[model samples]
Target: MKRRPRRSVPATLTAVVLLAACAFVAVAAIQPIVGETPWVSYRSVADALHGARWTDLVPAIAGGVAALLGLVLLLTAILPGKLTVLPLLGELDSGASRRSYRSTLRAAVSTVDGVSAAKVKLKRRKVSVKVTTGRTSTGGLADAVRGALERRLDQIVPAVRPAVKVKVHAVRSAS
Candidate 1:
């Protein structure tokens, strides 16, 4: 089974910190509104726990939760997936034909001199490749994969641009 890439600890922590900051900002933004509402008030932590109506607290809590979720999504956009897999999205055709195309591309790329493994998916005219190369120069491997993919794509799907939407996953050897 293929394993997804592992996220760096600092990146994960940074995401958490950003989410917390977003939540803080959201809560701060909403605090004045909560204060204006008759149901909610700012009291000591002890008082808030004891007798504050659930209705009053719920909205603010919900807002905080929503903010946190939004921040999480924002962070997700910034961070790469943990696995060495690329998700192909957009107007590509579905069913076995696409899968076959992906598999064919993967096979072709894997046969290249330095590539150890390859996974491919197509979306619209774009092809996404996640390739692990045995070569030490990840950048060169990526370029080679792109070049090979373009050649194959010209023969298979001539309408697509070789450069426009090729998502390349370049893996480096651990020294």
Candidate 2:
């Protein structure tokens, strides 16, 4: 069984924009037919569209904006987003929430020696570890943190193993 990533937020936003535009146009059209003042004049809109030439600046700008929007929407639909739930190594099809996974990895990293604080960020196929320590020297700390993270990951036994990248920062010693 394959787990699918969450829907693209840009795609959702695009859908919402399209829905709002359609609703606005429908309301404007219906108000004129129902003997009410429309927010936008349908006749004026038709005249503006008909009178505007493709070579005019206004029409050219509008066309460029529309084309850009379309391209963004197309890319959003085509790209795969980050997974909300990661697959676990189990026979019964179990999974773990991404938040929990990150927290677990953070805890494991924080337990390492000389690591004062740790932050873990999980991307599509990578784990970023940022560590802060007060030891003044950060040599080998990143590698140690990476090792701890890998050990924790091995214990958790997720179906896929992501590459780990660790960054360490050392605080000034109060000597």
Candidate maximizing lDDT: 2
Model 1 stretches astray by more than 4 angstroms: 1-96, 158-174
**Candidate 1: tens digits of C-alpha lDDT, residues 67-167:** 99778867766765533433333356422344566676787787778777776766544567777665565656667777787777665643334342333
Candidate 2 per-residue C-alpha lDDT over 71-124 given as tens digits, one digit per residue, 9 for 90 to 100: 977777787666777988977788888889999999999899999998888987
User: Candidate 2: what lDDT?
Assistant: 0.86
| Top TM-score hit | 2
- Model 1 lDDT on a 0 to 1 scale: 0.62
Clashes of each: 5, 0
- What TM-score does prediction 2 earn? 0.81
